[model samples]
Target: MVTLTSSTAAQRPDFAAIANWIKPNSKILDLGCGDGALLKYLQQKHRIFGFGVEIDDANVLGCLRNGINVIQSDLESGLSGFADNSFDYVILSQTLQAMKHTERIIREMLRVGREGIVSFPNFGHWKNRLQVIQGHMPVSDALPYHWYDTPNIHLCTLGDFENLCKQCDAKILERRVMKQDRPIRFLPNLRGKLAFYRFERQNKSPKSTQD
Candidate 1:
């Protein structure tokens, strides 16, 4: 798990970065929003209107305790509760790999909001690759789980995710790769253990009205 920073917000760096991308007073939806920390922080810092969707009972209670508007639902069912462009941003943080229907959920995110933000562990990091070379799955700070008990099922490299966005007709707006609290500038796929992306669906041009 990413460690919380000492800043007043006390959020993980990637969460803070995600917050920065959001505009003040915008409507936001957070998926798998454990404990509602990010949404609460944004409510206080950005004064944004935020809602959370969590499947776990404890987390749903946590969102209530945080005074965040939330609903208990499985993401696998998709975001059918919300209408198209219902929010300014929809976020799925560090939970993409665990999803059973990755493409469908991503499409749902874009469908329900103007933009989507996703973050996940980079399975192609050097440490993971080294472990693979040694015929073992990696056990690291970013992915601290054994193969059998791990929730993550469809882990992928940075390139894999980008290609997926393309296939979904999502336009990439920004991408960031990180190692702990710091951003990685060089050889991100090999060095960075985490990847973050902000994207939106492609728009079709309007037909000409002229005869």
Candidate 2:
């Protein structure tokens, strides 16, 4: 029943796009919620009830100022406090590269929510490819950092993500690769700046059948 202030609704398009992807009136959990923009957008637009988990003190305070419900926690520690299927969706946006155990956190996302959406900068972007050929790290809008100063703990390509999805028993329901802000449909592994996927965890076999 929360509504966005008209001023906040006019801010940016990407947040609008993210808000559109969420199901209306469903529970959501946003991990690494930077500034709580996406959660506030969802609450205002779709009437979704959810809380954001942010570690940065400034961001946590920002969420409070924005009238968003949020929990202050480090993602590296995992989401053990939340029960399985506690939320309809769990979102991780532009924060995957900074995690130490990416796979484990992804699994936790699946366990806590019925479905999960993950978005990250693609290390195989065309510019990055060129940088590798030139023996230097690529610096672009999506990944704007020098190697020594970057907080990214893991670098992954599109192919790597596909393999990881397979290994984790997650089924991709929707995917988008973007160049700048435009969606890229062809050879995304080579041309895209970021990759987004909506996924669900595959059901496991019964214990009797497994044995």
Candidate 3:
């Protein structure tokens, strides 16, 4: 869904913003954590303890090298194995758009952790819109694949994601739009390339699912 720009040597600025959001010593669960960069950063900057769930073997090895606790598991199966509110925060950075069962994953994230943070490439960015007008898939830093080959199966715009959150009764505590890792305050849907959302369930107890 999202690409890792730099190494653990150079931390992601948006994730730094996430670090600021979490309180010190809280527990975390990072979904699709790549190479344990965020977990490493959170420990150093916030003194938090946490685990990551990654399916990639190389990434799991990378997490071990980073001295971070990680679990190798598929996210599509959801967080059923974890106890309710097992973590203080659940993070799904830049991986939300690639998931096939996006709604289920969101609900599961809320169920397993008290709060959830997610980041994704904004599909409604001006460049993507212009490329649609030109009748071709846009290739850029945020979206770096050809139409057929892109790992992103369920792309969504900023508005679309917020609407989904509302439908699920998730309260968005914080939202940010970033361009070049800097926050964009004006017309973010057009200017920003990345969208970040931090949310929690309206009720910590799991809501009954009709389907």
Off by over 4 Å in 3: 1-11, 208-211
Worst 10 residues of 3 by lDDT: 1-10
**Stretches > 4 Å off in candidate 1:** 1-11, 204-211
Q: What is the TM-score of each candidate against the true structure?
A: 0.92, 0.90, 0.92
lDDT of 2 at 158: 85
Residues 1-211, model 1: lDDT tens digits: 2222338344377778788789999999999998788888787777899999999999888888878888999999888888778899999999999999998888888888899999999999999999999999899999999998999999999999999999888899999999987889899999999999999988622111111
- Tens digits of per-residue lDDT for model 2 on 41-88? 887788899799999999998888878889999998888878778899
For all candidates, the clash counts are 0, 0, 0
Kindly list the per-residue Cα lDDT of model 3 for residues 151-193, writing each as its tens digit: 9998889999999998778999999898875889899998989
1 or 2: which has the higher TM-score?
1
Candidates ranked by lDDT: 1, 3, 2
